[model samples]
Target: MTTPAHVAIIMDGNGRWAKARGLPRLAGHRAGVEALRQSVKTASRLGIEWLTVYAFSSENWSRPPSEVSDLLGLLKLFIRRDLAELHRSGVRVRVIGERDDLQPDIRLLLEEAESLTAGNGALNLVIAFNYGGRDEIVRAMRKIAADVEAGRTSSASITPQTVSEALDTNGIPDPDLVIRTSGEMRLSNFLLWQAAYSELIFLPCLWPDFTPEQFEEALRQFSVRERRFGGRNERDVVSSSA
Candidate 1:
């Protein structure tokens, strides 16, 4: 089977997971973190090279202050608790988003984690915190514009590849498969350009309830897809069968 080189996930329905169990939302987020840990282990064992998760979106700031604070605390806790083990396991952790919006300590921790795991080569795990697809695109555009103004690049030379290189995921391959849990069909402004042709899988299970089996099932389905990438139909199957 052709294993995907990169996989991205939009973990959804945490609040609903808590509501169904008569628990606080924070409890669900905690469970989600546990799920994330399991996912990392599973992905590594499956030989997937890159995994990117949408942990928090820029629009999440509209949430109640208390909830936002709890989320930030959880992020810090995850970094502190998992960074060393991840480094040891050959998992390089990276955070992609606007850093200025984060607390000073959290920003420092993010930088430290990135620096510590920079040498690892097993699995590249990226967390999208305080991230938005539109924002990322805008940031990339600004960068390209700056380069053009500095005479480093000309407007006539601008291309899709040029814009992609300016984005936060410059070195990473585009996700081959993107999974969103809780049966959500919308992309929610996640990885807009990067996921342009990615195969999407929507699972009914909530984020916390998602298991390794479900993840495997998604891969199984992904394996059956005909990824033509807008190419015309070909008779390769018939020719090979002959």
Candidate 2:
């Protein structure tokens, strides 16, 4: 089975999932963690090279204080409890987003996770916390501007590659498949710049309900479609599958 080299997911509807069950909102976030773990194992089994998930967004902080606290608490526990298992499983962990304002302990946890898994080669797992696509682009532009000001780079010589290297996902390949759960069609500022040509899959299942079977279905859907970057396809002469 030929799978896309990189896959990105916007895990949504955790709160809704809990509300539907008459459980507390935190109950939903906790269940979402389980879904995330299952996803990692499933993706690794399917031979996916890169898996990126939107764990938290820059806009998420605007939520209620208690909810934000619970989310961060879950993040802390995930790293503290699951980091060792991830290292043993050969998953390279990368956290993308701003960190300067993060709690000192959380910053250390992220750094520790990255350092421990830096040499692993199995599957790359990226957690986008406090990340926004537009913010990422602006951040990249600021970096490029600084380089140009320092006379290290010329503005006229800049290219797409130059800007890409400055973004939070500098070392990561752009996602070939971007999946948004809970039937959300919008990107929600997840990867605006990098998803220029990604094949998108929107599943109706909530994040907590996303299972391996659903994942396989998405991949199977991807396998049959022909990916032609913008230009006309040769198969168009007889038939087209888009």
Predicted model with the maximum TM-score: 2
Candidate 2 C-alpha lDDT tens digits along 89-182:
9999999998888889888988999999999989999999889999999999999999999999999999999999999999899999999899
lDDT of 1 by residue, 171-204 (tens): 8889999999998899999999999999999999
> Candidate 1: deviation at residue 175, Å?
0.2
For all predictions, the C-alpha RMSD in Å is: 2.3, 2.3
Cα TM-score per model: 0.96, 0.96
Best model per lDDT: 2
**Looking at model 1, which ten-residue stretch has the lowest summed lDDT?**
231-240
Candidate 1: C-alpha RMSD to true structure equals 2.3
Q: What is the lDDT of candidate 1?
A: 0.93
